[model samples]
Target: MAAVSPSPPAAASIDRGDSGLQAYARARLAEGDNALGLAVAGYRAALKQDPDRVEIARRSYVQALESGDGALALQSAALLDGAGMLPRDGTLLRIGDALARKDWQAASALTDRMTQEGNFSFLSAIVRSWIAVGQGNYAPPTIDAKDRFASLGQRYLDEHVAYQALNHRDLSAAIPAVRRALVARARDGAALRLTFAAQLAGIGARDEALMLLPADHANFNVARAAILRGRAKEQPFTPAQGYARLLARLAVDISSDPAGRALGLRLARMATFADPLGAEPHIVAARLLVEQDHAGAAVQEAAKVPAKNWFAPLAQAELIDALAASGNLAGALALARQQASVPGAEPERQVRLGRLLAESRDFDGAAAAFRAAQASYEPDKLPWTLLLFEGSALEQGKRWTEAREVLERAARIAPDEPAILNYLGYAQIERRQNVEAALELIKKASALKPDDAAIADSLGWAQFVTGNVAAAVPSLERAALGAPTDATINEHLGDALWTAGRRYEARYAWSAAAINAQGDVAARLAAKSEEGLKPEYAAP
Candidate 1:
């Protein structure tokens, strides 16, 4: 009791305790948990103990609001306003939300308060512009808001605003916004300006839009000169360089956007006439043509690439497939044979040739090609799937015993392969001696690739033959969905539909099959459909 020092004062101890509580609350908030409520309670309690801690309470409240708690956000916003710590934008955002909810007086008051502060005049103008647009009063306020954005060096925003102005037919507001964006970021912003200017020209601002070009950017300079000279078509200064640049742009644009890819394909195809030796353009043109369903045209385009290029074999194979698809099997087989005989042809060429030959019904030649191809290449490098082609050719040639042996060996090598399983299963089904075994093989194939139309069709057909017509319908329907344009799947669907007593739908499916089926298969399906119409139509 002599020199006790008064125990350091109770306020100091309370302040230290508050500091510890705030730190714990902040740490929990940082972990992204439900700490906003805890932080709000802690900050409020601390503020009660130390009323001077206004800034600390304001910060905690803001953090709680930003964590997506609308109730907490409103409460914190109120506390910040009470403490005089609310930023202008924060108040504006809250007011904007209130306005969106049709609280007109609150929004108007917030706008007036912000105008008085003079700190967020630009944002206030933008909000006012949006309100004007919403109210259908697109006059002085909209123009003023756009001007404010233009003055702030926000060109992208300005250009977008200009687009909105144009949509409203406010050419006066649009011109200034477009001009401001073009002037502020001329180099990187030329392309967008060119588009806007082209539109402005369409709306009778020819001189103004033309003036935006020739602004030090090369693309713009070229575009402006073209416009002034009345050149409706783009004529590049250096055709090769221009084509190269266009191709580069196309490549980048096509990476994520299909419409861009389609445009790029058209541009590349046009470029190919000028740059005949540039195989890159030809390859892209071929791919685009394929995507466009001009398979024959794609084959012709792909044939221009030299066989020595790395992509030559792939191009040739694609061309052959396309030719086959277009009902030019003879031509496809000839191209395959020519590719096979070419000097330094890769081992994969043999597989391609064999497959084409098999499709053309030259089974002995296909088998010989596959055998020669297998002998010359390493097993790892050889596409083991080619073995299925040899087996299929043998089976079609009525060498069933050998076909079964070869397919069984292929199945062992590629135990999990859906293609091999489907081929073997279908082969068994065709032989009509191992319906149960074929069903097992087809089921395995379907399990591996449930969405593969070819495998699904095989499985459904196998099930149908095994007297499981009800189970087959869903599989056939799924197959039809997966391969809407596939002739075989359509034929299978027709059979399933007929068995399910949907005779009209079955006939429609058969008509679709007749439209899409190719070569012998097409003929066979058509004949079968005709037979089904007869009173004595019988299943093979």
Candidate 2:
């Protein structure tokens, strides 16, 4: 994401009288590299120079908000609004600008107009609530029962306003509100709990607050410990902070659904500027940026979360993901290791480290991390899952004896878990150990999870290894359908297809496997595609 060094615009385009073409070309290049901030800048400059270009102004408005360029968003949004072609999110930018300047009348007027629109009335309600706070007689918005978005609205947005309305003024109603929000699985679950607990402690009800957090849950464990130490206590949100929270959560929710993704991202970028110091907005923005494949922007957003914020640890996880996504695997691993080494780190932190290590193909290190997590956790907490993780890592590292022993322990603890059953059965079949028992285990697993691709693959491979070619083909085909891009499964399917006399189809399957295959697997897949299945390539 280097600065926009615009290559010379094509002479023909310049002669065509488009002066902004050079800037537009630079913006396109930045967009290709996922440098959203740089792209936004180029688009902004292009829009300024070519104010009549509605397309440029619209793109600038969206990119400006996506890049957290509040001023640029306002400029483009105003341009678009003046042209009478602004979208709902562009209007939101204008409204946010009004809110920032404390122009309550303008903000309220914009929000009221939004209420007349067919959708996003919930968002308008949030904006109106913020404006009301400024006017000194604030009344939170109520959810409209008959509205088409009532389910989604009541789920998260209205709960925040309701919680604020009841809990801010009447402390007695806080517990019920918190319970309802938690039960509804509010979008900002951890942050909501922290805020609720903080409000409890603020009124000398520390005991009640402590009781709300059970010792066993990972995030809650950290909160409980921190609360006891008189640390990580967030103060009550101001009107601005509350407004930001509602917008951020709503933005994330909207971005998750495909129909309104761009609008959501634009709104989220606005949320970041609304309360710059608030952790929730940055966390939401970072996560959304990561999902959108803008790793650089995600990293920048995650870094904005203050260390003292309760959401800092969660933000750090986002930072690690952003680093990994941006191809800085070593840096991501090093940071994960550093975080995992924090004194009295929770089991979840260790689990996260193990996951990162496993992704990096450092199986031995991943196994160690999973083992450490297992040791640190309470006796009944995800014990079998941790054992399965360590066992899989050991298997990948070729420490099969240890892997077998650990996997057996997991099987004993979770006798009916399909994953454990499939893993142990598949490992045994691959090793030519206890074929009859392994087949039974695989059969049971398939019965338990009939639609699981990996389980189907394992069962098919089990049949192939035992020389049941006719029985394996259907299961192998089913596995391939469920996991179209899985190289190993495709290779297995090719072997079965070749054995079943589908020569051309077998070659096609092998070619598919070769698409993303690497090293020894690539060589094997290529050989199978060219020479058909050899004795070495197929199961015995």
Candidate 3:
């Protein structure tokens, strides 16, 4: 989060100081650092020298947007547009600015330009339709456009149309659009479901809306839909409210794209502005900021959610994570405790607190919190994940007997859970208990998750301890391939190789393991490399 300098700017040739290096530094700031203000300063200096560097301009624009400095984004965008050099996202930036001003004509023109340039293909048509709806010129794009767009694109457009109608209080018009979108997507995306729920509530079918959204789904959309259903009798919906949901949907749709997170963050920020009273956008923005490791920013955004909001608990949970991630572990722990003490906190909130405690190595506290979460579940339906967390925490605290008891219960509840299987199997093998049972559990786990390096190592070690040294060799070799730099896996492979009569490979494996080994592991690996495997390790 700090603004540590990436490198000293080159003193020579200030007029042409490798813009690429400055661009790279800017990128690192966007993708890693929390210091957008400092990044903006550096980007300005670089652009002063290399004014036409489109990439630099683009990064600067996004940094400004993420920092809540729309003025800077618009300024950088204007400069790029004036230079007749638009980056790939330049049009999106300009269009966002235009829509913010309610300048429908300007927004339409920007979309037209993007379409003329063949930049975004069907995206332009979608934007144009939304712009028209924003201006009350509801000339929806023709059905023929559906053929030009794939199912996802067509569904996106349908969602936009439904959103537009809802924004204008035309529930009759929205119903068909929502139906088409849902049918096209086969009822997949959370946002789509949320939209349909809102439409149903708007039509006075509150029961139907409640049925459309599952109560067990722990997300902002579902929470928002439930709120809408509850308020259907008293609250009046507005176009701005509709636009907020639309922006939230767009934000969700783009959040998974590696290159689209920045854009998604910007849209989420817009959603917040669209309806400041709504907590969903703030939650989404906080989540995205946390993913970028901008924990300080995430905390600020999450703290904006009103305490009385139904989704406030979710926001608070994220805020706690942000605090912990930003090195304020004490503050995070205190907040988690407070949330847990609330009269009716959700079970997931307690689970989150337990995970945080576990990550911070307060295993005893983690185990207690996880146990509390488990107690909250109905006697007939305990969540296996809660039991697994409790078991893992107990194991970390060296309470082997308690851990085994809880893990065995978890195994019964969710027999196919890979993590539970792997942890219990590995622990049993380490304790030299139930070798045959551990092998079966680990083998099932490996089949479920064949690519997990840790599970492979466990499977190999189990085979070795059970006197199947020759069989262990292939498993250990596979584990080493997947986790070449894992010291323990390398050591296991070395022992397996030595037992299989591959002395040279065993030494090589031991040496590789020693490279990154530490403490007792380092000492043991070094000795293994120097003196070879012990006599007791030889195969029968």
Question: Highest lDDT among the candidates is held by which one?
Answer: 2
Residue 320 displacement in candidate 3 (angstroms): 1.3
Give candidate 3 misplaced runs (Cα > 4 Å). Answer: 1-35, 48-50, 65-68, 79-87, 113-129, 138-145, 148-150, 153-247, 257-279, 304-311, 375-381, 501-519, 526-540
List, residue by residue over 499-524, the lDDT tens digit for candidate 2. 98999999998888889789989988
Winner on TM-score between 1 and 2 is 2
Ranking by lDDT: 2, 3, 1
TM-score of each model, paired residue for residue = 0.46, 0.83, 0.75
lDDT at 241 for candidate 3?
A: 50
| Best-fitting candidate, scored by TM-score | 2
What are the runs in model 1 whose C-alpha is more than 4 Å off? 1-264, 270-276, 287-335, 380-382, 484-487, 494-540
Q: Cα lDDT for residue 392, model 3?
A: 92
Kindly indicate the candidate among 1 and 3 with the higher lDDT: 3
Give stretches of model 2 more than 4 Å off: 1-18, 123-127, 144-148, 157-169, 197-236, 252-264, 375-378, 381-384, 408-418, 436-452
What is the TM-score (0 to 1) of candidate 3? 0.75
Q: What is the lDDT for 261 in model 2?
A: 71
**What tens-digit string does per-residue lDDT give for candidate 1 at 54-116?**
565565545443222344445556767887887654564455445545555566678678777
Full ranking by TM-score: 2, 3, 1
Per-candidate local distance difference test: 0.61, 0.77, 0.73
